[model samples]
Target: MTCMQLLLYSYPYVTRFDLRRLMGQKIKLTKSTIDKLPIPQMGARVDYFDTDCKGFGIRVSSNSRRFFVLKRVKGKLTRVMLKPYGVITPEQARVEANKAISKLYDGIDINAEKAKDNLKGMTLADALKKYFETKTLKPRTVENYGDLFRLYLDDWLHKPISGITKEMVATRHLNISNQNRKAAANNVMRTLRAVYNFANELHDDTLPPNPVKRLSNTGQWNKIERRQTVIPAKQLPQVFQAIQKLENPVIRDYILLLLFTGARRREMACLRWESVDLEAKIFTLMVTKNGKPLILPMSNFIYDIFNKRKALRENDYVFPGHGKTEHLIDSRKQVNAITQITAVEFTLHDLRRTFASNISGTVVGGYELKRLLNHSFGNDDVTAGYVIHSIEKLRIIMQEATDHLLMLCTAGKKINE
Candidate 1:
């Protein structure tokens, strides 16, 4: 019988010995022997091992022949492809196979090493995006983080996180502090630290140690005192008068509501009409910074403001704006205008502080004050855990505080006049 006809006829019943003899027993794979290896059936592949190199072999499929190495790595058998037969010479494939086998014996996981290399090359911007995707962050917090990066670390956004050294972070912190932005410098570094920490944990600690720790290590961090400024009770009338002069009624009422209710800037900014119940004399903040729904009773003064806004309602937001969010995002310009007019400098947060400071210990008990502020109870506050303040009960305390505040404003107006 012809050689080709005999090989095809005996293919189905061929033993390893018979197959080896058919290929001339030259198992030490050379170009000539590899070229003579028979292709398997259309749907199958045949593995031919090299006698000279233990674990080095060639896979002959119906369509192609590829070089491969099989070895046990970390106690698990693993196969790694070198290159196609035509892409490299048999000698080159054997060299690469030996190198791979050495690495495997040394307990180096090649796949994991490649993954670590890829993560090490991740840019700061990409890492931040991955962090945002993996964590549930508030929109305001996300915006704040974006602002911190843009304002301080814009130059480093495209650079790989690994390239950011401790010296660089320390120098940047000093430069920002020299700009009279000590608080901003601290915030930017804090944000960077969070992003780096997230990346390390996400990538199986592939990244270097967090560079921001240098600030704490060398006392390079800025010591910013917490702002305790509040609108003095005597300045209430002047502040109210300045707010009333604002051309934008939306902004004026927004500031007034913040002062009276002590709601956070974002919570009050994103207030919806559906969340306000004028008839029920209450308002609900469906989404709060603390991730808790806040149901607050509207004081008479706050009720009047909501009533006026209802007649002039322009959209879903209580304080509508022309911005993309369809709600008031920032009232800084108007607040700055008021600050200029009255010379009573304050921030939006200061308004909340003013509300709390005025009525905290006197107008409401400590438990009631905590409830009014929607503050989470600490683990050590055993009394707070037992006390439950209902909205109806809080309405009385809120009205009393509002009355006290209005009296102060009226007394100030009389003195001014």
Candidate 2:
């Protein structure tokens, strides 16, 4: 077989040999002498130690023989693979092994140090699998990891975790940001950061430190703009009227409820019938992104919307998807259709912004607005501790917001006198 084909067929099988079967029989090592030696039994390895070099040895299996150094540190034994036989002369192994053994004598753990260096060959994709095996993550967070690693950053999966340079990460982040969006780039790098950190802990000293850190260290991480788009006050009536014209009650009520409550799209999409308390006018999210379950007061309008959705419910999910994800996947097209009809260009999140804006300075205090939005203003604000509002107080605030939205929805429609 050709040299390239020989390596291609044998490399994987050679790496699988149980080198631990090494019996450590000492021999006076030489290149010609080692070459003349017989191969061991299939799947097993035998160690031929050198009498002249204390830690120097050669491991021979059926497929290949390799030179290695072994040392005992802190009462634990470790082996460091050096070079494959035929690639390195026995004299070369002897000289290299002497230097490594001297370090062991000086109390340095050469094998452990070598182990750290082995991390340089481990790919980012391998680290992700190892991280998943070691950590328990939220399902949504797990999904995000899959998206970042497998979908978005697939090109980098095979690259060594330790080999990813700071320049590579920075330029890649910038490229992804330009090609996709800033948020996508940020999230991709954030997941890369997590996977890189796990691999660093796994390899410790051997691999190069995380390249993702350069973004933070140099303050070059993209400062993403917080979108503040909202349907204008004058456009609310036009928007609501367009929503009213939609044929599907599912999409209609879905858009209306979002405008009224300002709950995130995924939060609303994942809602279940059991979480809704119609009589109490409250929606309970048993598990939320922040791990805090929301017992949010729903205004009469949202309560009425839920009542309609409940009757149409064919599944546990509030907005059950027809395809693989099994939840309302993307409402971008539905939202864009509404935008077209009303000439009010808006995102689903804009409905959230609209809810907050319409209710602010109109029906309740700023703190109450934050409460209605289920927002946690930073803990740095001392008065945030004392501004807690009860459900009854929040209910009053929610009712006012609901009533105001209704007026906007019906503003220009005159009743027959």
Clashes of 2: 1
Instruction: For residues 357-385, write the lDDT of model 2, one tens digit per residue.
Output: 88889787888887667777787978988
Estimate, for each residue in 1-417, the C-alpha lDDT of model 1 and write its tens digit: 654444555476676567556552328789999998876667666677899999899887888999988887767998887799999999999999999989989888876777787887799999999988988988878999999999999999999988899999999999999999999999999999999998888679767799999999999888888899899988988898888779999999999888888889888989999998899999998768788989999887889889999999999999998989999988889999998998998999998999899898879887887787788999998988789878889999999988877777677344236
10 residues in a row with least lDDT, candidate 1? 1-10
lDDT of model number 1? 0.86
Candidate with the greatest lDDT versus the true structure: 1
Deviation from native of the Cα of residue 212 in model 1, angstroms: 2.1
- Please report, in order, the local distance difference test score of every candidate based on alpha carbons: 0.86, 0.78
